[model samples]
Target chain A: MSCGSSPFGALADDTRRAVLSLLSEHGELTVTQIAEQFTHIGRTAVSMQLRVLRDAGLVKERRAGKYRYYSLRVEPVHEVISFLNSLYGASLDGLARAAEASADQEPAAASDAPDPTGTDKDTPRWGISY
Target chain B: MGNLVLSQQRHLALPPADVFALLGSDRTAGWLFGADYQALRVGALVQFELPLNPDDPNGSTVDAFGRIASLTPPHRLVIDQQSPWVGRLICTLTPVSGGRGTVVRLGVEVPEDAVTWLLRQRGYDPLEEPTPPATVRIGVLTSKSGPASVFAAATENLARMAAAEVNADGGVAGTGHKVHVVLRDDASKPEVGAVQFRRMVAVEGCRAVVTNVTSEVFDAVAPLARRLGALLIYTPVNEGGRFRPGVMRLGERPRGQLRLALPTLVREAGGKRCYLVGNDYVWPRTTNRVARAEIERIGGVVVGEQYRALGTTRFDDLIEDIAAAGADLIVSTFVGSDEARFERQSYAAGLRDTTRTLSLAFDESTREFTGDDAARGVWTTFNYFQELGSDGNTAFLRRYRATFGATAPPLSSITESVYEAIHMLAASGALNTDANLTELVSAVRAQRFSPTWPSAQPEQRRTGEKALYLAESIPGGFRISAN
Candidate 1:
């Protein structure tokens, strides 16, 4: 299925968000399985949501004999996630470089030393692990 | 039981046997933080290779191990972990009605910090972050239908008023979070109350639940509170039991109220023969047991005793038996509308002319429902009465009438306890921080409610608060005894 023009439209509904979270928690689930988790809504309504997600390329549908299974497709949101990762990564790199440059310019100046996370003064604290 | 617990539940559209198959599959490692093992037998080892960074596919991993402590096929599984995530993990699967699905309950007995770390690794925020104040939601569960609905008449109004008052006074102590109250109706049934109680905690995110339902509901939801890591505060007179951690049964016990009311009632009646009548339930049965002991100690003879179904309206036969037994005093443990019906029927039978009745659950709303003619000369015991002559009570009554209008359901000990419970939670400051069970109990013990609230003092150990005043019903309201 094509991701249509805008993926944001498909993410606007509350049920779709919850469906996405459930799909993320469990890698894959059948249409009936998803419907069971949400007793408040019917099977037809869940199928409609899955169809919406499939149309938006947010989830992949697989057919096995008489049953159908659905799983979250990370491709549509992968672009946005990679962009955010780069944004944070670039900011951290720039901060570390700036601190290293300042430390090198004033090697003997105690005030200009970068605050290292470890005991070694050479290691900068700006590397992203989170 | 461990020092901390992390619990989650999911409804699967599969039977318990199928769910057990899924649990034994390798796919579970996806949600269980990379804990991989397909062995379903007891004493099998499971190794955890949890990702250090969930967002990065090639990030370093942390290693831990656990062994299967017990494995009950298609039902329960227990695993004992070592080191970093040191505790036990329990999984239970139960088949739902109609044989269409199963409900899976998972609990991890680990420290709070370790759970927080695990959540963070799973791409979630830290569990104990207090920055950027959150609105503390408290759930109020009261009966709006069925037999005991009358007891909850003022519960919702009083709880909302207390929430508004707490917010106006700068929210819970030390936290700037505004107070939010989520009201739910239990329908006076234990099963419905348990469902609503779970919804309030799991779905609505209520930090603590203040219940104005019967003790039957309390028994149903007490275990759920511990499993869900939320507080259950019950507000009603009860036969106190060995309540579990994370549950605060803040209601008065029947023993204390009986000790205060039976003596005066017996002395005024000028007889030692007493009859006991109540609805069939744990609270009623427990109260009767205490009454039996108290009556014997006070030199009284047990004349006749009987229990009726909760919503039974026909008391003619019971009243006839009570009159035939020649009892001078009667102890009525009937609750809500049942209590009112018994009083009115007894009055109609002319049993009230010679016999004195001491009702354990009678309050202003019930007396109003019973009317002045039938309720007059009836004795009751409680920690609060709207007719209390105190400046704090006067101000409270003024605000209550102004907020709910003059025709609102009259406040009684049962309803007043709901208001006091919210303030008690605020006083303990348990809403702001992740306080442990001991810290919570001690913090609550150190608190004394305002003069407007009841003077009942919470016990040092397990039992709830206790302070009783004997009152007699008059034309308009009740006259609380000086003692």
Candidate 2:
């Protein structure tokens, strides 16, 4: 991972996400074990993805008896989760404000009032701002 | 031209023979899924079955036919593939200095699409290369959530497939530049779309945007595209009128779809009383307005008209009103989930016994979601359908199904339009530069796009005028009605 590269960037890849899920489920997995999970990609690709995860601090490596085992470290993802929470929160706020603004523009009594022009056109109603 | 060669080298903690053994015979099947040849030989035929989903081992698989060209155990192995995408795969194993581990050099003579797809499958950066190609970022905004989510299921997949094909065929008019597709979800809201649109252009440096969201999102993002100097192309059915500068519309217009299908539908149904139903939006409102006029021109009476909110599932009362009005012809402009629900509810109410429905936004996916029993006999018109019998359509569907397995979401006009739009943008070559909106639009209009890939005899059409086909819902899928 380089400067300004978020952990979410590491999670963007399908295989990486699968690997993380596998590690999270199994607690720890060797490179060969992780590679066995993916039939389309080779062990070389699996190793590269593990390296990326390690660099992003999304996974930690533990070497024992001439073999390396990788485990999940989900600290970096907490930031991303919080960011998503904030995004949803902000959108809800914006939606509430939009609804309030539309309510102010159109009075409640005017909603049911028939068109005086006797045309098929609908009266000015408060839109949902889609 | 010969296929491009992709090279990879990995140092493994194994001897030369051990490493060679790993990539050969039954061991090779561990990664390749299924290989017929156990002991590799020079003249032996090799077959591989690559799983569509790597996570699901017992799921569907795609066959890869190949023949071994050269084989030297512990040294080198080469194979030539014939089916799917033609390629020559080579693997070389070399012993380390101390015989501690072996160094493997793997190279595949394949198209960029295959190489990128392989890289992507492995969670590697597909665009990352030794000598990285110049990239033209294109933002694709679709409704991954909200009312239109049902219709947008395949938009992202089809758009990515088109971009991959473009890159494989030497990238955007042979400029040696790759199109990097950046996808964003608008949540079926214009406000969210506008935010995502700005982020794509400003933060992500996108030069062009292809949208599969609602028309409301277009109304919000069109002006922003002009101000930001980015090309915006909206792909899906919409009310056609005027084109905004820096924005291009490449979908079936309401006028064309209704004109071609309504007359035949009304005549066959043997009714002149029409009930207009749609969602309350610019598209549905505009479509209903046009539908009303078309109904009158054909000496038909407008029995009833109503616009419900988006995502309205309950059509119980609406069905009662239509039944009470004794509507013979039903013109439905409801979209996605709403469309599916309306079709189901109306069919359940036995409305189909007396009334015939002409759905403006019904596609293969919508038909499937609506269920075959409920959606049967419903009429729809669009520029493209997955059930089209044309040779070009067959090849297009074959390629699409090959890329995304047989069980993948069915193709729809709404989804197919995104593929066409992406191809058109790449064909223009304006994506490879910082051209202004006017120049981009002109360049795009000057080019024609093929709806099918790897087509020997392509059915090319301009975005302005595409051939429309009328289809009726049948068991399993749609039946394209003969004009």
Candidate 3:
């Protein structure tokens, strides 16, 4: 898991992901309150993880007096989701175009549609399937 | 000195008219210079004799004279002097708010070439020769990023300020060269520090380099500096160690700091049993030995001791152990963010309620990182503090604030020492004369120049008799308490 360059790299850790999840559920929490939720790890460790999350833009902090409040930033997560959707959506569009072209060129290309029932192949497949 | 400029200001409780009357009267003129002068008016020559020593009858006197350049009643007065040194003097008076008082400001501007002549006239040796080269280059190595970055803030700013001041006074003393500072960040890594050191010497042609970095990085850079035959002035408080010949250590020795602080800790703070904690390095380890020896000498026991790797953030177990040790004080030698982390965690663990902390390396910059409450009541010893009350320090602080504004990084001993070292180097004729590394080192060691801030005593060897002030952490910073 990377913690230097990419924001997603910060969420790759179980503890950091857990921290983001907690912040997402709770809206905002101080370092002490967040540390209290985890008994196994020390506060310093949590603070360090929070620092990494903060550096990666996964969490934003607000200071009230001496206390610092950390909250989950959804913009980074939304950007990641949009990025992944674009990647898969492009490939799915290409596949749909290829299937349509094959049907238009080869009217009897019944295997391309993969009929589940043999009776569908006996009729005009396009009209029957529709 | 011909190039010397003296600017002084005072806020008087009297009104502007009264202040102006006093300044213009012959009585005040006699007090300023021991003779009556012509009435204050434009184009009038004012002459007076200044006795070298007023108490001694056999002492010599110098004829000081000036021409009144401009006169604006109850507002501004300008005088141009050419006798002892070629300079210009200006005085201003402005009314204070509510018609209550007046603000008086006096300024003196002299050329740099006449500074040596003026010093000679005053029976003092000039810091440098009368002529200086066209330009000179100095190198600075500091951490701009990494774990040590917290302590490295304002290192470059202070060095630049020193260089700018020197250049403004007409370059280096004899060479007449403008001082140029080449700054490079070590990234708080040993190898990177070595590389930067080599680049500064071999590439930048710097004869001397000042380092404000960790002992680890300093140790790595020291050998390279020696091999290159360049002068290294180390400016961080470190564990006392054996160094090369041309290298000068300006930081306080751990033995000296703890020697002065431990006895007071045991007596005033009632700290008998102490817990030792620090980063596992030469500085902390060596300093801890000094602390332990001092504690034992003072009839105190070392209840517990622990070391963490550099950059270690987890301090829960250590705090728990310290609390369980039943010690009255925690002697920590941690540096930078590690110190802040340890202090904050210790406070959270409730150890601070019963225990007092005496850190070897805690400074103003470090206190900013550790929240006010987390670091409250913690004690540290240093030669300089930002809030020190002295005329020289007051002027220095005023100039620094005016230059960098209020949001500048807090002034710590490390950065201040860098400023001192640069000025000391210039005073030693390193930049003014064509001396090699060994000769320059010898010259620097021989001269006893007064630092800008008041040290315990004048500097003799590479180390000086520093009056360490023990301070307790307050809300914004450390407050020097009664020793």
Candidate 4:
């Protein structure tokens, strides 16, 4: 299968992502050559990993001397860069959510203190100071 | 470059195998903990609360966590540790190797905030006059307040006693180095502990810190020690399984404890049906994981195990479940206040009527807190106690009673191990003058340290050459069992 515009997240697994590192570290290694870095696994496993990286546009491949050589095409990291930007936004949004949660819990706590009148302080804020 | 990403960034030339190898390096793990000593390194994620508290034991107690931002190379690591306490935090690691060994000093500069600059107060001189290169400084970053305050009291005394003994005799191998200890309070919080540790190294000129508080606190300090190029002496929950190079763990590693205790427990129970309980967290989580594995390995069955939330005050529901398990033994790891609560409640639930309990954490202080009546019939195991051994123990007990008052520091297992950590470190530090962290580390690794061991080999069989001994609760204190 080929990587679509929205398939960026699918390429995040170790096998797919590590392909670039393997190629870059060794410089233009064949599927077999790249597989040497991950020798604990089988050669076909390495080829499948390389396929994912090629689909992600994170690796460039060519047939040389009857063997397939894969090189790093790091241009796709720009998409990863955007994904990381989104991650930062999500993290900040999480912080904001946490802030709102604490803010909401505060009045519930304060209202239980008992108002000056005979009413319970936390009697559902129908009116607001703001 | 390889995956040797222990520093922030890679040189882009190292291979993954080399990087992975470095990851497993003790030297690498040492720098991973703290970056306090040198000017700083690139991608050096040292946790520094710049604006620190001078009087408080732990420096600006910031709950710090972060990822390595950028590894610049050669002598600098820029760690991106952002926390509530730090608006901007950068730890710079620079090697200041005066001679053969590198003096990695971590310089933490706060360019953005003044709320966090708790360096040594100007003109205060947090450290003493510089001694020669051969001297060794060990600080006790203890807690006088907070949850761990009780344990810290004995640990501080223990460390001091060990230093006193080392200095009184000929200091380590005629290195002629005097052992000095500085006490700082962690308030039982890791943030506080990390900060205090930073200040102790940066200001007080300490090279090592010894503690056995918690995995949370230990984790916090461990990373910081790497940043500072100092060593942390740990008496971890499972003795010292986490014993890396710069990090040295002394007693009863959880694996070692189980290796010894589980088999004995199975033999004593006459079968493998076991009930386990812990104050649900790191210590118990690890203990149960190892326990379950051991039980399966030994062809035993774990009937019931309950891990309660930390700070849980009651264990009635858990005990009820434990009682229903029909198990022969109850294994536990409840520490501090929860320990007492668990014991008293377990006794109240009448679980003891059917089950024989074996504890991994109860000791003299725990019994004192829970009342011996409630703690009675509970069998506890540990590495050391004042009651365990001979002339050394008698002298230690006499001095401890005299120092803390007869009723205080009743020689609990945790405190005794911590006390022994100090004695061992001081003894090794004095003998070692290679003056490198690794040398002192090797010395500690080579030393057999059970300050309270009686007749057994320096290492007990149960905790694997640990002073780990078992005793059943009596009316007064624990009695070291012959079994």
Candidate 5:
């Protein structure tokens, strides 16, 4: 399953997003780990929702005997990162300036990075050390 | 000593009207000296070394160092400085009639410094010389107040001292006239600089104009100098690309300077990704674009970039977001006043040690404003030293302290340019020996000033080259890394 492809996939519920957020932050979580904050819904509903998350590729599940845990998938994580990047396209501009002070204008001249600890990093106008 | 004037040098007698136009050139306030200095005649070889602030020993930013080539006659001059930042300005001065007065039209050079530096640093060199009175007028159009005032303001005082000393000496031709600096406050706004530039010419009757500034402000005054028949001496650049024919830009361009700071930081943290932070303005945004282009070129990735408008003082949310991104480095471009607040907040948010900030335009003046704590270990670059171990710098500080009653902040290459502009003009003036615009213009094109040279002012000299210095914030204050 993919984002926006499920019958509930097209549905972007606040409760469902909260579940994904918890799983992402904590890596993998059991039903109890996810249900702790979703007091509005009981454990059974969260378990069912976890099943939905797994179906949408937004999460994955692993069973350790008595308990089952859910983890965020790298694909969806990458997708979210892309979305966030597009949303905040203007970040890093301020930060890149820190590097701008020293060799700020010189882009990489070749396919490789310059020696990270080379004292002559600034020797070439087109050289890059990072 | 104060009323000395020059006797003729080349046995040239001027017609009454032509002489009046030349002498009365003083009425044209703010006249800038360009390549074809109205005062410089044909066949003058100015043998002067480009004066730098002399601080770049740690591979820091190097700017505005070169040697004078030749001052040919009748609107043509050639220089031997190997600066890629300048596009080999083939300035041609043509004097025309404007509003019943003569106008000196000019042409200029605009090139990327990286290319120039690449050529020179890789063994590219130029050779030449001549001896003609290439009369020039040195003008300074620096911001005296407002946002960008701090960087270029001290340049005025340094120019004053430099000009005074240069003129008191035998002048450029070892003659008698002294140099006079026509100062104005740009208010750090392009519009204001534009208006002030006009006033400096129309009202002040300044022969030449000198200024260190951004493109916006340089754009405002570049054409006006041509119209009024003055020379335009450009000093210490913020960004490149503003070379008009009549304009002689004398400073390190942006790319050459930025090349000094990048690459090293990218590898220090061992991550291929970066986040950029800077003032949401042309300089920083352009810097971001270049960095990302460079990063991608090197196989590294730009994780992200962020910008805040000019006066933002908050960073809590921004810091949290950066930490979440897990970037190895967070680059910064926040200049002057904004720098302190950003660092304090970045540290408070637990992102300080996680990231290192490198800045441009945060010099000693900035350190004074931000204090030693907020900027500790924060690195920046320039061509002068407020904290370097140099006798020349020591003398500069002593004079400034005596004059202003307190030590002046670090004078960067731009500020030093201001000082050099004034003295160079005075030297040129010594040959013709006049105070008005035309002679002032001639005085500059013919003169040279150094950061550590000796003169009548006891504070200035004709040292040939200016060097770059790099310093980082340490305990007592910012210390020179390689010094």
Candidate 6:
């Protein structure tokens, strides 16, 4: 999903994230089965969390003979990954352009600047602070 | 210009053609509860039997006659119903994008002017002509002449008193508008209540409505109010588990009332073996479930339980059964005149001498009808009693007596609840003619005003929270015991 459409807001809770993890490990599980795995919470609470996840389009539900089976939808996760990739790719392109501009002006300022490798002693190359 | 409109939409997982076939073909009888209709075409007539009250199993059925006003194959169907109530129905079907499903929309509309004319012809005019701009109309729905009328004896009188009191005090807060009260008698029928509720909203332009009737009538009107975006303040003593948007119940719940009443009955009155009896309906059934649990919790044995239909007057056989069971206590949940008949017949059967009776439905007006001899020694528990000794109650009684004079209807919990409801509306800033549902509901939930008589304490859910009192019937009225 796009950043605005991501289910991360629903997964922010630890219990909901655990529910997602459980559904990912197991193919499909009913509300009773999912609730049985938790010791501190109750079936109603788990079902409510599942409802939130369902409303967020992070899970799909099916009915089979009085039982409801819930399974995770992977398309939203793929969309979230694509959104992250695009965001990081844009940042990397900006960094590459900055490096090229520095290289083009290196010869003109070679005598003035001692560091020919385009590395400033005070600044880290990875653009990260300690 | 006013029209009552009802619209409902649903999505089916079948194609549009399949859905249309189900709506148009004779096969619809199977799913529509055996409805009989002519072929789907313009000018065709359709007849069906719809339940008078869905909440009542034994309720009567009325015939619905409709003529096809327009027809478009598998796409749209418009039918006009011209019996009991005047209304037009339209159904539309559209295919979904996937071509495997369909969206269906059903709508019903009734012209308010025709309904108002019909009501006036029946000697009931719940709407007024050309409401003044500076007046806030509040609709009052109650049973004025029916089987349940005994319970709502003072509802209209008390509501009028409250309105007058509010208008005397400079009208509603923030808005200097006088209150105009519109009264409608549901006649203890859910169908009637539903139609009246629509008329009040669509024609009278009521900002809010106060309903004091049976749970069945409330059930029928609540959904319509929600659909019409009308604010409904339900005041009654029934099963009391209903919660919805724009609907607030400010009455005693079965669990809360029984929790206090049953345990006290078992301990103080020595009620070891208990029997249950009530009208056969959803409210009685659900309430008895809670009463049964509470009786069991208090170390009492339930000897027998029985239910009779509403308006059932003869109780000789039921009284004989209660006597045969030799139960020490009878927890009667009957409402209105049915309750009076049971009490009087039980007294005549001499069951009153050996067995004590605790009624959840017993109030001052019902007690008056039950007679002094029959009601004597009978016990009841409720949130409000007219004899309550409080500064607020004394002043309220004095003002009520002064306004209505000596021959007024006796004040009871049901009536006082309606009285309290009007004040609650004013206190919550819901008396404004322009208030919306969200604003009114939120104001009611956040309200904590104390009326002259305290029932339940103010809470967010609109359920009353007050100290319950147990009283014994005296010659003409109840002698409330110290709590």
Highest lDDT, which number? 2
Q: Model 6, range A1-130, lDDT digits (tens) per residue?
A: 0112221111134477567757866879999999999999999999998997787667889999999999887555334333323322222222223332433444443333333332221210111111
User: What's chain A's TM-score in each predicted model?
Assistant: 0.53, 0.54, 0.54, 0.49, 0.51, 0.54
lDDT of 1 by residue, B63-124 (tens): 34455778888788787654233456777777764544455566655544343333322222
Ranking by lDDT: 2, 6, 1, 3, 4, 5
| Poorest 10 consecutive residues by lDDT, candidate 3 chain B | B120-129
The candidate maximizing DockQ is 4
Error of 1 at B406 (Å): 0.9
Predicted candidate 4 versus true structure: per-residue lDDT over A1-130, tens digit per residue: 1122332111244454355545545668887766766747878998887776677566788887788777876454334234322322222222223323333445542233222111111111111111
The local distance difference test score of model 5 is: 0.49
Per-residue CA lDDT of model 3 for B1-483, tens digit only, reads 124344545444444565555543433222232233355766454543433333322344333445577889778877665343345667677675444344556565655533433322211211222223456677888865445766554676688888888778766655667777876666566866886687677655777888879998998988887788788899878776785887888787888888777876766557699999998878888988988898898889999999998767789989988888898988999888789879989988888778888998898877866767889968888877777776667777877878865445678887788887777676666653245888877766654333332231223322545667788899877888743
Which predicted model would earn the best TM-score? Answer: 2
Writing each residue's lDDT as its tens digit, candidate 5 over A11-116 gives 2444675676566457788989788888689999998877876775667778899988788765542332232222112111111122222222233311122322
Model 2 over residues B1-483: C-alpha lDDT tens digits?
234544545444445664455443332223331255534655444545544433334444443445577888878877765333345667676776465345555555654443333332223322222234588878889875456766554786788898899898888864658888887666577866886687678656788899978897789888998899888888888897676788888788888888898888888778899999999889989999999998898899999999899868699999999999999999999988689879989999999999999999998767866777899879999878787667877888888878865434678878887887788788776666566678777777665443222421225343234678888898878888844
> What DockQ class does candidate 3 belong to?
incorrect
lDDT of 4 at B13: 17
Docking class of 4: incorrect
Model 2 misplaced regions, further than 4 Å = A1-130, B1-133, B448-465
**Candidate 5 at B57: error in angstroms?**
49
lDDT of 6 by residue, B204-305 (tens): 788789988888888898898878888888877867665789888877788887776776676655668999999888788888888889888878889999
The DockQ values of the predictions, listed in order, are: 0.01, 0.02, 0.01, 0.03, 0.01, 0.01
Error of 1 at A76 (Å): 35
TM-score of each: 0.58, 0.59, 0.57, 0.53, 0.49, 0.58
| Candidate 2: Cα lDDT at B153 | 46
Error of 6 at B171 (Å): 0.9
